[model samples]
Target: MEVKIMEGGPNDPACPLMVDSSQVTQISEGDERDVVQSLVEIIERIGSYGDYRRTQRKECFNLVRRMKLLAPLLEEVGEMERPLPEEAIACFCKLKKAFMSAKKLLRTCHDGSKIYLALESESVAGRFHSVNEKLNFALDDMPYELLGISDEVKEQVELMCLQLRRSKRRTDTQDIELAMDTMVVFSKKDDRNADSAILERLANKLELHTVPELRAESIVVRKLIKERSGQNSETTQQIIDLLNKFKKIAGIEENQGYGIDNVFLPKSLEKSPSLLIPNDFLCPITLEIMTDPVIIATGQTYERSSIQKWLESGHRTCPKTRLTLSHLSLAPNYALRNLISLWCEKYNVELPKKENTSLGSEGSSEHKEEISAVVRDLSSHLEAQRAAVIKIRLLSKENPDNRVLIAREGAIPHLIGLLSYPESKIQENAVTSLLNLSLDEGNKRLIAKAEAIPAIIEVLRRGSMEARENSAAALFSLSTVDENKVTIGSLNGIPPLVDLLREGTIRGKKDAATALFNLSLNQANKLRAVKTGAIPPLLQLLQDKNLGMVDEALSILSLLAMIPEGHGVIGQQSFIQTLVELIKEGTPKNKECAVALLLDLGLTNSFHILAALQFGVYEHLIELVQSGNNRAQRKASSLLQHMSKCEQVP
Candidate 1:
């Protein structure tokens, strides 16, 4: 239809101009002279029907009702004397009612559908469906004349018809998009007849005939709702009234323990979308997600790792309220450990421990039957020879290469799911599973696709020391992929890793060092770390009391210093001092790391070489070369030869 663009009145709320209905009906009936002109007017003024219907709901409904009531009255007057004016008014009223009602019903269905979802009860679901059926029936009653107004309107109508027909003719992907478009149309304001007809048609197409209320839109909603918090306002009230039933379900509640206050977000981490875990809810240890939810004897749940990490970090007061969390009466519920154990027992192909007896009670026939059933189930699915680890070990003795490092890919997703459980053991298992799975690129891609990176990164920040350690290893493997590197950078992995290195346990320190070592392999990542002021913490690692950790730290630093640009960023006072200290007091491994770092730095500039010579690096290296373990002696020889070459080149 030709839509006319008309100027809005000064008082109009920046809306499109609306066309008068009488002129349009007159043009539609039999007159072709003003049809194009009237169509242009309507098209020009076609303010989004969706927006107008939303703000003017009550006004629109009242207008439509008056027009419907006046239709017969005007027609009767037209039969009497001088009825042209009355006839015009009657036609105008009928046309207004048709278009206005269509828009109003569309809005009602959209909002009502959202409420129906929160109801969730079967009886209430039936009631909502009944209302839906009525709406659909009403839509079907709309006059086909409205759609046939002009060729332009005809085009839109025909398109809708073709889509509806195509959807029925085949099981193609286009049907999904068409279904989605139908939802959008239903969301708009439409007259009762149009609204009900679309609903009925969509219901049939979607096999929603039983209860048409659950249109395609509701299906999408149900998929998004992971868990039911049970407490919903609108639909819950409607359903309770209909079914006369009351029930309680978990909803958003304050997370006790860590003192961080809540904030709002588009989606929630919890099942209830309303709950907001504060942005600043840093775990005290790794300063990330609370690895375990701790329930004290007093019946309260707090983030376990967060509270512990805070205490270990020497934060006497809570970050939120500044209350002394350490003194708060509390104990670890071992929630994580228990959950992890259960999952491992059920799904783990490789049992961490051996069972000494039958899985069930002895002697009773029932017990024997159950045990036999369990064994049979295991044998049918899992390889019988490998179902039991003891059996696998016997086979491995004869065939060495047959042993596999991982049990299954689901192991990671399963472990990752455990992170949602309120247990540390589950989190630990998840971290271990991720670490073990990272042994291959295929597994890494799968984990990445599952959106495990962000969750794993979050866990590392909030998980237990062991969790944090394992997470670092997993992230290190993930960083090898370019996409994961960007993900790691986005989640602010540098500061957390630096914090872990500075304050973590021996294992945490080692993992953090290794993670950073892997991270340094990427120039962009190394630059990001350097830019984030991580050089000091990383440099401090060169002097780690643990030889293995020192070696790993020095190795990453050596790699970073190898590039001319990398040397400019990493070759600073902090790095030089740490290297000098390692040269003076480090073990053989530490010495090798320091030497590797120096060579990379000197390759860019002789400045690091001259500094090393001044710091007695040459003497330590010569002594090691002259006498020591073969590995240490070889490293010492390697360092001296490089230094001698540097001198000769100058």
Candidate 2:
């Protein structure tokens, strides 16, 4: 399409230089290794621009400097031991591709018609400006958390993107003036000889006044036309027309056989060296992101169907390397599957559906018989016991009614026994099964009555991460029954759970916090929790913004603060400062909790009230009294009244 011009300049149709879609870099989709290597190659290519006959050398060097800054981040990505999650690989690919296209544009500035370049100097700036915008887009697309990028490198890249965004409005007066003068020469079409001195100056400006220089210019413009093959025809034609004018002024002739016939074959750009699957998320066989990934004996992960198909086809080998397999069994790759799930959720891509296995009601007598098998085979083959408990876990997970049936069939006691198993997976499956069974109210009582609380707490202290996390969950579920809460606390469950809350995974911490929250609801267990030193972790969780535990921490602290031990530990000036911060910056619910906690503290100690005043809490209290929620308003007004009384007394 002929772009509309702004009525000046011979960069014919110097419209905002609308980027041609064809100019967008097309990165061939590759596997994890290829993705990392592509990033390295693109960075190298971008850095390879020499100082050879380059226009806008400063801008080109600036582009190189920006790309070099990203190399440290790429090196970190390359050194990562784990495969880059599919989404992170995609981000790297996008960043690499953007730099690749920018490299090509920079190459044009290095070797294309210098007189045409000097003429369209503003357009040259626009090209540099355009690539920076592309880079900004790629950087904005990546989720930094997916990659293991260091804070320093991430900050540098972020700052680079900020500069690129701000560079859009940058201009150069010299380029603009030179561009206008060159346009005037192109405008005087018939009066070609009328500006020999102008042509001499243009030739001098571009170092193109010599015959050999004229010959080289003709050859380059011709080569560019052949390379373009007429895509950027108007720009190439302007380059041609300008080159020919210079030739006429230099008493030289255009070389028709300027080696355009050889068709300088560019190297193949397919860049195919590895797996056809696009990324780590994809199954090597199916070439799609695996919803249910499984690892085979060869230690290769593939979608469930891919593994099934491979084994079904009588191929006893890993599809990726075609290597011989030691065994045909496939294990669930829970870790990669989880990563894929997070990637899908982040990108808002829906997972493909699997057949629904969740029955609406309890399984029949046959299923009950299977539950007996778990109890019957409790001390049998380890694998069989594991398989049985996993079956029980799956059944219990299907529905609440099924859990009642599974518990009645005497699987809970055996599952709890298996929690002490030596094999980690069996222990994980067993504890998880008990956790599932404990979801039913009756099963919660039975599981607690079976002396399972100590065993579950043992697993919480030393089981596999999944097992420990599930033990905490099981504790939380069982603690839901008011009677079981006392049983759990009496079994010495509160301390290990407090430890898990202090030093566990985010899920484990959440589960431990919830169990503690429920157990603390019982007055005696509140003292038990306090004695176990739950205050420090609770305070840590309150300060953590990413864990989403602020509300729960405040609630638990508010409850514990009602007692003397809680008040002693939680009523410190630092804790009070955190509450005041919450009142100023937290959500309305958070404000209400902070206000209530502060009011409780202030009613007992004048220091907390005065500290509130000293921390500049009066205006915040005034704002809360006006616009806060009803509970917040009431709490704030009461606190204000308390502060007023404190001021009068002191």
Candidate 3:
């Protein structure tokens, strides 16, 4: 069948007959044909719906070319032979006539009287232009009203306009799918504005669902919400409803992961007035909403009522893990600490600074004023600072500045009270305070006078890293005076400190090493550490991946290994074996430390001699002897000489 462009009326012998069955199937079959027809019609209209209101002549030539391109495909779909080359000229001529006729009719704005003329005419392109111009003009304002028309009439007219514009744009299948999806999602929203203009414009280029239909869906959901929203238990029911809707959606992933708010609300509400709970309870640090608010040590749900109990214990949550904080998990800046700081500031409080000490010369006048100003402020806020100080006393470790303060004349008794607080930060802080106070001769005598050593040592045995480190530092400080050294050694601090050497964190390990180092300065503490299995861990730590830790451990081990018992410990265990391996395999600095330690340990045992010889520790020592680092050469030579002497010692 030949494709025909409608002219004026049914009188034209060239009047085209659309394959009625094909057109009907394309319209209602709701398959790919519907998609194709809908798309083709939209494109044709956008292409041919020329602007007629312009006084200047605008080109509708592109629209003609577009219609000509789609005419062949429409013909092919009707199972007609492809239009002959001659049919193109006839189609163009007929289209031009119809559009011109439509343009003339639109001039009257006669209530779509022009549309009826355009549809009825077979030979007049004037009718086509009239309908196109009016739609383009009307759609330029309100589009939604046009979309709300009856589907039957809309689909038929839309198919004709779209077929003409289809050739204007070569839209891809993906573009069509995206356009469909965008229409589906956006058209469902409540839009009450001049949507007619948009819908009319879209009718020219898109298949947006009617705005009225969208509003109807919203009305349905709103009715449902009205019927259900009055119940007191509605929020929980709403969650269930939302989840059910989610589950009903086809192809939703089965494992969507847990919902944070849904799981936590019941227990959280049971424990506290729900009003006190923020609608969104999120951790400030993590920024995600909180779940499973566990209480540490107290075994209670963390809620408004339990928050005070946690604060009293000087603990806060793990910033990363979102777990209930204990001494083991507390962050550096506990929320309570900030709370206390805010409390101090609110009441006009100031924190104390360390004692004003000049580095070299006597105080300048400017420095003196600064110091005096600080002291005055500290005095004014002393109560608040003391409160903060009291809180710090509860920790198992003392921050360095706090340690310095406790060494002053009056910080001990207040620190002692926190040992019973059960919070490790408090206990640690108490230990730190004791450490500081022990450093001063007067305070040391006072601590001994108060018999604080036993209590301090008890914490050393069971306290957190902060507590142990501070206690160790304190024990070191106390032993600076002879009586205190004997006092500390007698309290069984060596075994615990060494135990910490094996199990402590890097900082804890460092503290343990330093503590042993301090104790080694006193001969009894040196023997005690060597007797308490400190050598192997210290030796192991000397090979630590952390260079600074390695240096500190080696220095401590080097100091302790000078003692006879220390020498025996190093030789008897694989301490010497590990060191010999380190010397053979380690960097020059490590080799130097290992060899120096071996020399100090005297290389007496058969295991020490055999391992050192088997591992070629002597060869590395010789290489070190040739190096320019005088320290390495000296230590290496000393090690070789010691190995020579070990042969005679046994």
Candidate 4:
């Protein structure tokens, strides 16, 4: 089957083909005839330049250059016509691959001087310019519409065009303008007037011949002022007003004398002492004047509502001091509350009514009896047990005292028993109740003593999504006890937890990672987790966008990287690269973890030391040494010293 390239029509037999017809037919099947025919025409057009390589080498070289540019566009066209015939797709792929191979082979066949000689002979440079113009005109006329293209493919093509435009050299001012025009066009096409407006402003600013850095800063400041002006915050509005007044008083023009460094400082801009509220009168949590003030054990006072909400959410530290509270107790700071009230009165501001600071602290004995009744009903009929579990869970969430009371009623054993029940709902509520109860330090021990680790592991393995998450949370709380960590690992709990890390919901993943993190603290448990194939999922969790999970995941990996087997598993180039990236771009804690992990890996092998250097870890370490916290700075300094010694050896 000979497929000849016809100049006019398929029946025009007088036309000459560039390659042997047999070669064209061998490249494609019958279904691809039309697409193959179109491609062959393009190839023939490109091959015509070969005839002139000897007498007109420059023209031929220019033709080849034009074909090089068109090759990407041709590939893109083929991509847009998907659901395309397999033969056509195959033909395109083969053509692209073969063309690149042939070009490479041709280049390798000649020395650089000989290639230059051929290109420069026969006035080729002048002739090539003519050929280039013709090729550009032909490309301009070529029809590559978006008619049959999918939206995704269209966007991809547009992105390709955008990248090509961006990669153009900007040494020429014309190129910069063209780039700006390209951005404006793209922004308009996306129906984003804000983006287009930004581009237009940049172009107009460029015309002023301002320094790029100054112009960029000016634009940023203007945008900030505009955004702040629109916000409803009083502080933001005040800042905007102050800026405007400063500009007016200093006779500063927005376009002319605007640089962040050149701003005039006025004495009046400093906050006056009269405007300051006494620090002790402000709640540390809300940073506002205290109303219904309550004092924690750390001696820091917070608004009652704020402090209660913090404690209810399971935080156990003073917001201001970060000292662990001796208990979740809040006593009314009557003196501070009265001072705030007097201050408000003197300032002619209306003081808000005091919040109800009590959370049933003095409930009647009847209420206590009711809670005890619910705890005892756990052994009754199934419906009664369900209601009782729900009531206990509610009570436990209300106050720390309630949690202690529920724990004293011997609910831990019943909750552990209900975890293995047939109904998923019962298991979920039971696990929820246990999670709440375990928050109490005393109950954590009792739950651990009851050997509830196995039941929680069961829920983690087979419960519903919510149930699994709660079970993982319960495990996390229980593992806070050193004994439970050992027990959970010994009960084959590591593998299921690792499985949850791999397949659980976002909340479940966080809980499982945290649980594994706690368990990994035990040396034996770290080995067990790694033996259960926890490293890969842990590494995968490091890639998560959730900062909490990433932090926990990194902490676990840091611990695992200590042992010989753990070091060997984590010292892979890919893992090292991920850590390097995190060090450069992740949150502060993540940066700390990454630096620590890299330090561990570097200790295991000189190869890791070299790998870290390749990944630009030295600069990050130097930065950390200068500015990071004590732990980060210490580890980074040690690693840097070690790396420096390695560098000195040669």
Best by lDDT: 2
* lDDT tens digits, residue span 141-162, model 3: 2222322434454454455456
| lDDT per residue as tens, model 1, 374-434 | 3343234323312332232232222111212222313344445555545666566556555
| Alpha-carbon runs more than 4 Å astray in model 4 | 1-362, 546-548, 619-637, 647-650
Specify the poorest-scoring 10-residue window by lDDT in model 1. Answer: 243-252
Q: List the residue pairs that clash in candidate 2.
A: none
Tens-digit lDDT track for model 4 on 1-650? Answer: 44333333213443221333344446444434455345545655555434332223333453355455444455555454444433334334334333433343233222112212222222233333333333333333233453253456545535533433332211111222222223233323233212222222233333311222223323344444455555545433333333332232221223223323222211221233234557677554443456688788998777787777566544566755668889877788888778877876776555445667566333334556777899899989999999999888788763555776777778889999999999988998899888887766678888888988888989989999888887887887777667888889999988888988899886667667767876887899989988899999988877766534676677678778878889889888888888888878887667866787787788779888887788888888888888775446656777887798786321
Residue 217, candidate 1: C-alpha displacement in angstroms: 61
Off by over 4 Å in 1: 1-426, 436-441, 477-487, 546-548, 563-566, 573-578, 624-650
Best by TM-score: 4
What is the lDDT, from 0 to 100, of the residue 499 in candidate 4? 85
Could you report the Cα RMSD, in angstroms, for every candidate shown? 29.5, 30.4, 33.2, 28.4
Question: Which of the predicted structures, 1 or 3, would earn the higher TM-score when compared with the native?
Answer: 3
Q: Positional deviation of 503 in candidate 3, in angstroms?
A: 1.4
Positional deviation of residue 18's Cα in model 1 after best superposition, in angstroms = 99
Off by over 4 Å in 3: 1-409, 436-442, 585-588, 603-607, 642-650
lDDT of 1 at 305: 41
Candidate 2 per-residue C-alpha lDDT over 264-293 given as tens digits, one digit per residue, 9 for 90 to 100:
111111132121222677555433456788
Overall local distance difference test of candidate 3? 0.46
